[model samples]
Target: MASSTVNRWLRPEVYPLFAAVGVAVGICGFQLVRNICTNPEVRVTKENRAAGVLDNFDEGEKYSQHFVRRFVRNKSPEIMPSINSFFSDPKL
Candidate 1:
């Protein structure tokens, strides 16, 4: 009686576990084939390679330099006498 009960519990669960493992392996194999067929250089060329052409090269560095110049120019009090007047000692 106990053996029959053990067999009943084991028989129903085995096929589901096998099916789940088979599905997981099939998905991994499909993704592996997909990645192998897609070339990295082709993908990069399709997206960002055009933006990295000569016209855009060093753009970020140039913009950074422009930003530094603007920031330094704005830092001096002479750029706006009104700003100094607003904060200057009221007693004077």
Candidate 2:
């Protein structure tokens, strides 16, 4: 009886969990692409690594990116131009 119940779950009911996992993986992939596209430094680092120029990841003064810290520090300068244009521009 226990084996039968486990089998039932292992067949059809397990699919929803699999679907949810697939969706989650897809979302994560999209977020990774979005991050690469938005951060020029990160994108450059990735390219360097791919090209083998950045062979030793631990070789220097290089440190992990703290996106939140950098984003917070740079937010005002980053946002002001876009915000100004957003308000100034008229819609077609």
lDDT of 2 by residue, 1-92 (tens): 99998887789768999899999999999878866765334535655657643445553223344555565765665448888979889978
Against the true structure, candidate 1 has what lDDT? 0.64
lDDT for each residue of candidate 1 in 2-82, tens digit (9 for 90 to 100)? 999878757866879878988999999976765555423223444555654344436545544564577777565576778
How many angstroms is residue 68 displaced in model 2 relative to the true structure, after the best TM-score fit?
19
What's the true lDDT of residue 81 in model 1? 76
Which residue pairs collide, candidate 1?
none
Candidate achieving the largest lDDT: 2
Task: Please report, in order, the local distance difference test score of every candidate based on alpha carbons.
Answer: 0.64, 0.66
Top candidate on TM-score is: 2
